[model samples]
Target: MTGETAPVAARDEADPVAVIEVQAAVLTRNFELLRRRSGFDSQLDRAGYLLLLALDSLGPSDIGTLAAALGLDPSTVGRQVAAAEGKGLVTRNPDPQDRRRSVVTASPDGLARMAELSVARQRRTTKMLAGWSVEDLAQLARMFTRYNEEVAHHYFTGIDQVGCAAPHDQPKHSTAEDDS
Candidate 1:
């Protein structure tokens, strides 16, 4: 680890909140780097990329569904979808079940572009974590998955009622080092 990251790692072992804060900062920096390195920033903005990902993961969906899933306003999603459609990245079809609603899906070209971007991201991530052992990578993956699951559960369970919970307050688990 670099002199900069060593302090953060030391703090992470003692303070879960510190770890979370550092993780957030790292994610923000990584996202900016990825946006610059990948050509997606030139072709699509953050909202567009998120919309495409939602469509890819959730299949064809209506504007309202996409908006809710993405935590974006419906009008915002509508405009993004329109822009993507114009760029031939997405297609709109009348919902068979409801003629009044139109569902959006990625076009063949969009899928191909998304696939290319995915590969680029994977390659970049692999290179960035090149020194990490397999066990370390697996631990990171598990930790991220667990964190996301907890946040999702809290979010979907009525954020007004439950509010956000601190990571350390949730539960305790064996450290990655303990797994060895």
Candidate 2:
């Protein structure tokens, strides 16, 4: 007897939201896996991790500047920084040029911890790319870099607003198509 095939639903031409949602979910899961493998998730929550990254990248920065860069409230940034300070991972000091401002910097211990985390992250990333050829990896990286740049540009240009939206706040744009 011939086997019968199951019916499959046709793709919706108008919906893109589902596409974005799925992509976001996949990226989130990948990041979670990476963080877990690197022991980052166990050591710090997302905010704290971000704080560490900012300190690493920007060197010492005043609380206000850090808060702005992180898109977090000043109080929230302060709390996270305080926690990092308490762990002896960072130091808070009065800004040399501005007595009214305080800057946060990663301490020696923090840098060492970050180095360990970085190595773990790199190892995981390398494993994930192991199946890809160098050319393929380079192409993939280029696409990702371009996408990131475009997205950041859109956000910074005020074309893609960033704020909490109620269910009613979503634009009435068609969600039936997957742009990808």
Best by lDDT: 1
C-alpha lDDT of all candidate models, in order: 0.72, 0.66
TM values, all candidates: 0.70, 0.66
Per-residue CA lDDT of candidate 1, range 132-174, in tens?
A: 9999999998777676656544443211111222223323355
* Model 2 agreement with the true structure over 1-180: per-residue lDDT tens digits: 365434332355256765655565667776876667666766555666667777777678888767655555689889999998998888998888988889899888877776676677678778978998999988977767666545434332211122111122222333446234
Colliding pairs, model 2: 14-176, 14-177, 15-175, 15-176, 15-177, 16-175, 16-177
What TM-score number comes out for model 1?
0.70
Which candidate number has the best TM-score? 1
Candidate 2 yields a Cα-based lDDT of 0.66
Please give the lDDT score at residue 82 for candidate 1: 96
Residue-level error in angstroms, candidate 1, position 165:
21
